[model samples]
Structures are given as C-alpha cells and as structure tokens.
Target: MLDVLSEGFKEAKLKLKGKAVLNESNVKEAIDAIRKSLLEADVEYSVTKNFLQRVQEKALGQEVALRAGKGDSRVAVSPADHFVMICKEELEQLMGPVNAELNMAVNRPTTIMMVGLQGSGKTTSTGKLAKYLVNKDKKKPLLVAADIYRPAAVQQLKVLGERIGVPVFHKEGADPVTICKEALQKAFDLGCDVVLFDTAGRLTIDSALMQELADIQSATKPDNVLLVCDAMMGQDAVTTAKSFDERLSLSGVIMTKLDGDARGGAALSIKEVTGKPIKFLGMGEDLDRLEEFRPEGLASRILGLGDIVGLMQDFQKVAEEDQEAQALKLLQGQFSYIDFYKQIEMIQKMGSLKDLIAKMPMQDMIPKGANIDDRELTKVKAMIDSMTKRERIGQDNLDRPRMARIARGSGRPVKEVEELHKRFTAMRKMMGMLGKNMGGLLGKIPGMGTLGQMNNMRKAASQMGQMPGGLGGMGDMGSMFGDSASKPKPAFDREKQKKMRKAAKDARKRNRK
Candidate 1:
C-alpha cells in the first residue's frame, strides 16, 4: 500500500551503488535524500529530523569502521546493505515491537475506550474488536454506544453488534458518559469480561471533543485508551494522536484505513511520537477485518514485498482449533465441500477479498486492465451454501436434476451451479498434483514448511482459489504439475501448465539477462 515509500527506499538504496565507503560526504547526500523522502511521505517534521540524525550517525560510524579494516575488508558488506540495516532497525524501534495483543486481564470487565476524530473508523473498530474478543478470545465483550451526539451512530453500533452476535449497551436519549457508566455496571452485573466504549469523534481535534473525551476517561477509568487514527489522514493522523493522547491518556494506538493506497507515514510516525504500542489495525469496513499490528511485517510490506509471514499468522489465528488436522488432510486431496466451506469461513474472518489479493506474490504478475473480478468469492460462497450436507460431501450423487435443485436452494442459476461443480472437481484434481510436487514448491518459498503445515495449506488454498475459473479455471493447480500425473484429466492440461511455468521462468531469466 505504501507504494510511494517503497519506491523512495528503492531509490535511496540505489544511490549507494559503486560507493566503497559511507563517509560523511557520500552519506550526507544519501541522508538528505532520505530525509526529503520522509518529509514527502508526510512524516512529522520533528520525527524526520531525529530519525535521519540517527541513520546518519550509524552510516558515518560504519564508514570509519570500514577504513580501519575491522577484521575483514575483503568481505566487507556493501554500503547499501549497511544502509538498509540501519533504516530497518531504526524503523522497527520507532514502530515498537512485533505485535500487540489486547489485554483482557485488566480488572475483569476490562474497559477499552476508543477515541479519535470523525472518519477514523472508531465505531467500526469498536465492533471489530468486540467481535474479535468474542470469537477469538472467547470473551463476552459488550459494545457500549457512548457516542450519543449522532443518533445514527448508536444505531450503527447496534446493527454491527447484532450482525456479529455481540450485545450492545445503549440508552437512546441518555448522555454518553451516563450510558457508559451504566454500561460498566451492566457488564459487571451480566458477568461480561470486556467492555468497549465507543466515544464521539469530531471533524478535527477540537477543544469540546477533547474535554468530553477527558470527562469520559475520568468517569470510566478505562484500562486501555485506544486512539484510532486514519492512515489516509497522513501527518494529520499524528497530530490527532498527540491531541487525543493529551486528553485521553491513551494506552495504545489503532491506525485505521491501513488498506488504503496511501504512503502510510501516519502509522510509522504515530507509534514513534505516542510511545504507545499500536494494538490493532483496522484494514477494512467489515466487522471481522481487524488485525493485530505487527511492525516487522508492516515495514517489510512498505518495502514492497508481500508479507507472507503475516499472511500465515492471519490464517493460523482464524483456523478452527478442531479443524486443523482436517484442513491438513483436505490439502492431501480428500477435501469435501464441508472442508472447503470451513476454509472459506476462515478466509472471510481474515479480512476483505481485495486485501487478500493485495498480499499475493502474483499481484505484480497480473496484467493491468485484466478486470480480475473479486465478486467471485461471494458467488462461490453462495453456491456452497446452496448444497445439502449430503450433496456437499458426496458430489457423485448430484445428477442434472439434483444440480438444478441445489441451484434453486442457493437461489443461483443452474449455470452457476455447474460452475461450482466444475471448480470443486478441479480443486480435487489439483490437490492430488500438489501432493506430488508440494515438496519442491514449498522448498522454493522460505518459511513455508511441508505441504501438511497449516501455513502452506492456507497459502496454496488462497493461490489456487484465485486462479482463473477459480477451481474450474484453466490455470488452476492442474496446470501447476506438468505431464507426469496419469489417468484423470484435470481442468487444465500439461501443455498449458508448461507454458505458464516457462513464461514465469523466462521472466526471471530475462531480468538476469
């Protein structure tokens, strides 16, 4: 998403090429360029100054050490390597640690008060966190509608609460502070373990809103004060974080709109100045779209490579505890529609369809203006729901009449039903091939273990699902394995697969050539 920042880093790294040492003269030019890049990315002016100063100090130190021939000048690391290391270390430190987990032990019925300016997705995040706690943490979290200024705001929270199966504590005409106080009492009485207070947000950091937030803080004495800043707001997000922290005594930050194509200077600068861990990230508008913030993965992503590690962790968390073994088995080609449906639900829990696509290594492989439709996921989900359990498990039982009946059940046309059948059949055939060649493919990608590992299975499932025709699509996993497999014909054949792989290999070879 931080395409601009990634490009700037690439440019800065290129400046050090052919340089033997990072002396003051050479390093000064490089540091100045980086400083300008940070400013252009909308990083706070003060943070940019101090950050560059640290990098410059490290760069100059490295140059001096190199001239002294410390140990081995023959094996001296490139200045670009050293430069990247310095930046990566400083950026990680600025962004705090790897991940931040929500606290549920802060005096039972832990109160989390959300504060931010309007359009920060404060309301949506509150519901997302409540859903996460209920589903992931197995805690009873009550969503309190304390933002009473906008009448529709309360209704919005209630609707989200209903959709996610969480209880909303609200009083339509009551004052926000009063509603919160009552909600806390209600939570205690109902034996709820967590309470999320959604406070009012203003257009900007105004005094009235600040004072109101302060009043809520004093009244609620919340265990965690989460400031929801929007990445699209840029440096203004930093300013908002600072202003909100001053009034609310924020415990952590939750940067929303992270899925946007902005440079993401806000997330980098917010944690730097606030000195508070970013507890959660709101990537989309869905109730289940919240992700725990991880600095290393985010930094890597801003550098333009996909965060494969982060994607694995996201899948790991969403996978059902009991379904782990089954999911692994399904990867070996015994996957039924029930197994497939569970995987789909896990994916839905992770985030938006667009978000998952953005994280694929093949994202750059796709041609421009290809009209890669994302709505197919919804269609797939609908078809799966339409099938009876017996039919889902034993697809051989489905004849033309049965297919039409299933299509009617799902409210989809018979053609759609046929499409699903074709895709599912393809998935079965492809998995058999993956079973044979997964070792080599898995080895090529670092951190992906054997095919049976949850990580590899999830990655393979996502990649396989995204190919053309999805499962029935010609480029599905069937094409991934060349001519070796015998008997049953898959959706794709040997020649098509050979062409795709040859094209991929040629592209890499051309880069070297």
Candidate 2:
C-alpha cells in the first residue's frame, strides 16, 4: 500500500544521499523527479505542486558542507534526509494533526448522509458504519434506504439491515427526497439516536445525481456527509472525491477496498486534496472488519509493523461504552476463574484476537505450526459459566476444596481451572502495570508510539506470552519466537478470507454489466 509513493521517495532520497556536494542543478533535478513521482501516484495537481514547492524551497535553503573523513569527503546531512523530512511534515500537515472519527451525535438522533460513485461501497459501508455505531458505540441506530434509482439498492439495504438486526426505512417506487423525509420521521418516532442514510451513486458525477443528493441534503440536513470511494480506483478516486465534495460538501470520507492490492493512493491523497478526514476504511465485507482511519498508524503499516493503532481504535470505540468500561475496570485487579471467562467474551467483540495481534509487531511471538487457539475461547467461556459471580470476580473466594467443587460443577478438571486462574491472575497484574507505563514506554513500541495516554488495554496481550510459562503450553513456542523460523504455514479458513476476492470479482462483474 502506498508503494508508489514509498518507492518514489526512496529513489529520490538515494539520488541525493551519494553526492559529496549539493549544487543547484542536482537539487532541482532530484526535486523534479520527486514531483513527477507524486503526480504519477494520482495525487491532486494542486496538492502535488504545493508539496514539491515546499521541498524545493527547503532544499535550496540548506547549506551543503563537506566533511573530510577517513578516505574522502562526503556531503554531511545529505539532502536526502532534508528532503524526506520536509515531505513527511508537509504530508502530515495536509492530512491533519489527528485522524478524525465518525461524528455521531450523542444527543438523540445522529444523522449521516453517504454519497459517492456507484460500486464505491456506499450501501455496504452504510451498514458497516451503522454496525460500528450500534455494536461498538452502543448507539441505537436505524438505516435509511434513500437510493431510489437503482432497483436492487433498496433491497440491498434491507438485507444488510436484517443481517445486522438494524431497521431500514424504505418504500419501493418512492422518490429519494420523499424517502429521506419519511426516514427522518421514522427515526424521530423510533427514538433512534443515529440515522444512517444510504444515498444514490452514479458511474460518474452528473447534474441529475448531484441534484438528487442536494435535494436529500436539503430535506434531511444530515449531521454528517461521508463520501465512499474505492481505494483500488487510484487516480479516479481523487477525481471522484473532488466532484463529490463540490456537490455534497462532504463531512468526511469512507475508503473502501483497502484490503485489496490497491496502492492506497486514495487513502493518502483524498484528505490532502479534498481537505476531509478519512473517517473509516472498509478492510473487509464483514460487519466487524471496518476500521477507523489513523494516518500515522497507516504510515507505520505501509512501512513495516502492522496497524496496531487501528486495532486499538476499534477497541476504544467499544470500550468507551459504560458496561464494557466497567467490566475492564473490574478485571484490572485480581483475576478470578470467573473474571477470566468474562474477559474471553469481551475480547471477541473487538475482532479476531489472533488476527488483531498478528497485525502488530508480535506476530513472531506465537508458537510455530500451532494454530491460534481461537477455538479455546469457547472452552474458557464454558469454564467460567460453571462458577458463581463471586468466584468469577475473585479467585480469593475459591479455596482448594472450592476449586474442586467449581471444576466439578463446570464439568472441567481441577488442573484446567487452576491453570486458567494462574494465567488470568498474571495477565491482570501485567495489564495493570502496563496501564501505568502506557503513556511513556508502551507508546514507544514502533507504530504504537502516539496513542499517548489513551493506549488500549488490548495491547497487553502481546507482552503476556513474552513472560515465563506464558507460552510454554503452546507447541513449538520456541521456533515461533526463535531467530530462525520454519516454513509452511497452516492454511486459514477460505470462507473467512472473502472480502478481497469478492471485491475483485464484484468490480469485474460491475464493469462488465
């Protein structure tokens, strides 16, 4: 992702790194090359021009000095570093200081209007965002089917609503403007705190589509307007974003198909040109796969370590709710056999725990050839069900005799219960300590350096296996964490990996039809 920009900048940096002295001719040549790279990456023309101008200005201002070292003289503080730093700062400035999230009104009914080109995942993303709001934010949400032009669009919204158990407001053969008016009325009557309107899309921007969208905006006056754009479209994504912003005046963007092999130009360039935050990215078609956009975290993923920051953002959204927050607060201290069970359940809502950890730097820490114990979660849950609330919250309530009785009641062995108790106790202690140091130490861990005080407790799982006996149970833990690794990874479930393949096939079929 962002490979073109990454490769372009790397090449430009190399050009200036070897030179002994920087001159006007070589500097201009290098800056010119960088400028072309940005242009070719599908960056907006205006953004590219301003970006290159700043880099050139900074390069020209720096005084190149030759230092006599071991064998010959070399250009100290190579223009490459200067050039890279300027581009980084300007890119960051363009993207903004902090990534923005969906602005769901906390009051009564938060209304969001989605607009974009057809097949940009506007309808799919509308459902996904609604799920995020309902399941993660704990907000009562209702979906609005406002795309009246396409025959299947309303049914699509209805299907998604049923799948996620959210209500959809739509009337066949009704005009989009009228449907939006009725939808808002329904939201008010139902007391839905958030109403997500799935608007119409076109192959490209046209006056008619704009007029329809404008009419909906005039009628509904949605609290937020999100433009959904396909990341695989590359330069096309930029042009479409520009057109939509001019018409709808979007509040933010939702970039779809990032899980595909796209170069991710849309993810970077949209905010730079359109001046709107990328609120969310459709990593997969699954309701749980949508992730909040984080510029620095994405930059790290493109560089190397996976987007742990993105994973934290997902958890933060859910954990912010009162019930989930209270559960976490209770588990921070002593872990009982019962609390251990509750933790397993809470973790699942956050996404595949194994996949979440793999995206971060700790992928190598798991046991070699041993499939992640995604299934063991159920067993743990069963064990917790056997215990009383008091025993679940604190093992102190369970003595040797009590442990035996609890195991018998749960239909598990005494050793299994004891081992779970031990692991949970250790993990709770580790997490509590990590909580204190999250602002400084845990934040320093590569891509996670920025979360500052808001570091999510989910990150503490990586450190658990690093400690003694933490990984001993998993087979071949040594090779997984060893310097030399083995070959042949176990196959993952084919059905679970549906998003990318389906996205490609869908795009192809859509183009053909």
lDDT of each: 0.74, 0.70
TM-score, predicted candidate 2 vs. hidden true structure: 0.58
Candidate 1 segments exceeding 4 Å error: 14-33, 63-79, 98-108, 321-349, 357-373, 376-513
lDDT of 1 by residue, 1-513 (tens): 665666666567778877877777877777777777677778888988998899888877754334324456555568876787688778877787855765556666888998888878889999988888887779998899988886599899999989988788988678888998899889988888999999998887778888888888889888888988889888888877777777677889888887874577887888888777888888878776788887776776655445787788777767756765785665577778887777767777777555564465443343323333445556677887877778888745778998898778767788767756765766675575566456656767553345465555455455444433432233432322222221235576789999999999999999998
Highest lDDT scorer: 1
Model 2 bad stretches (over 4 Å): 12-37, 59-84, 97-108, 302-308, 314-513
Worst 10 residues of 1 by lDDT: 478-487
Per-prediction TM-score, please? 0.69, 0.58
- Can you write out model 2's per-residue Cα lDDT over 1-513, one digit (the tens) per residue? 455655566567667877766667777777777677666667767777877787677677877444424556554565555556566666666666565566656556888999988988889998998887887678878898888877688899899999998899988778888988888779889888888889888888899999999999999888899989898898789888888888788898888987563256676678887787887878667787787676666654433345666776766655634665655564455435554444456666666554455456543344433455555676667667877777766634657787798678867778766756655655676556554554455457544334542344444444443333222232234432332343336689887689879998999999998
lDDT score, candidate 2: 0.70
